[model samples]
Target chain A: MKAKVYVMLKEGVLDPQGAAVQHALGALGFDGVEGVRQGKVIELDLATGTTEATVREMCEKLLANTVIESYRIEM
Target chain B: MKAKVYVMLKEGVLDPQGAAVQHALGALGFDGVEGVRQGKVIELDLATGTTEATVREMCEKLLANTVIESYRIEM
Candidate 1:
């Protein structure tokens, strides 16, 4: 099975990278972009029987820094 | 309105970062991980009426490097 993890900054966290992208968009004449938040997606090809709990453990251990980011897993 | 863009390296492209992550996971005893691919997600809070075409244009122009990456947009 395949598991996809989306790791994003928590609400209220400042995202400089996202702000930079939004600024560039505005400069390029693509107005109306009011906010931007950048994150990461990690796709894991897991062996059969690898449960969702294991994926969550992976996220907690290595995939995300939970202090400022949150991760969601889709199997 | 909101737009979420997912950008990933095209298949057959070498992803060293992903390989490294896989290696780390294996080192940490995650044995069933067969493959890993890393990507980026950009979430945009758009002004009302900002069309999907505009989001695609942004991906084409700045959010994704079409030569090596492909993007999917959710509006």
Candidate 2:
């Protein structure tokens, strides 16, 4: 099984890296962009029959910082 | 419109961050992981009618380093 994890900052958290990207895009003259949020994707190649619950535990334990981020998993 | 851009290192690239995460997971007793790869996701909020071409341009010009990374865009 393969698992893909998306870890993104929470709604109220400020993302400086995302802000920098948005600002740079404006400087490049593609001004249609209004907002930007940057996140992480971790792809795991797991043994067959690895359950989604195990992947979720990985996210909670190490993949994501729950205080400032939220994560979703796809298997 | 919204664009979700995923930037990942090419297959041949060495991903030390991913290796570290995999090692950590093993230390934490979840040993089914065979491999791991880390990537970035950038979400863009654009004006309605923004074309996929525009997002591709962003990836080519700034969002991804095409020499070592490949990017996919979802709108």
Candidate 3:
């Protein structure tokens, strides 16, 4: 089985790295690029028959920094 | 316009960070968590009428480390 876990910063959190990317976009002459927020995705190849609940537990336990990020699991 | 860019390490690249996470997961008693590969997503809020081509340029120019990562855009 294959599972993909996407972890992203919660809205209202400051993303300095993302802000820098936004600034760079403007510098490169790309107009209307307002802001950027960055996050992570973790892809796993597991043995067959893994359940979605198990993947969610993985996200909660290790894949995401829940203090400032939210994660969604896709199989 | 809003663009979501997903950036990830190219396969065959060594991801020490991901390996560490996998190790930790096994340590925490999660079986079948075979491998972990990590990546990033950049979400942007732009003025209306931005083109996907323009966003790809943004990605090539600054948002991604193309030497080892690839990016896909979602509008």
DockQ of each: 0.95, 0.91, 0.85
The 10-residue segment of model 2 chain B with minimum total lDDT is B52-61
The full ranking of all candidates by DockQ, starting with the best, is 1, 2, 3
Predicted candidate 1 versus true structure: per-residue lDDT over B1-75, tens digit per residue: 989999999999999989999999999999999999999999999999988888999999999999999999999
TM-score of each: 0.99, 0.97, 0.93
lDDT of 3 by residue, B1-75 (tens): 778999888989899989998999999999998788888888899899998988888888888889998988999
Better of 1 and 3 by lDDT: 1
From the highest TM-score down, the ranking of the candidates is: 1, 2, 3
- Taken over the whole model, the C-alpha lDDT of each candidate is 0.96, 0.96, 0.87
Query: Which residue pairs show backbone clashes in model 3?
Result: none
Task: Give residue B4's lDDT in candidate 2 (0 to 100).
Answer: 100
lDDT of 3 at A25: 83
The Cα RMSD in angstroms, rounded to one decimal, for candidate 1 relative to the true structure is 0.5
- Report the number of the highest-TM-score candidate: 1
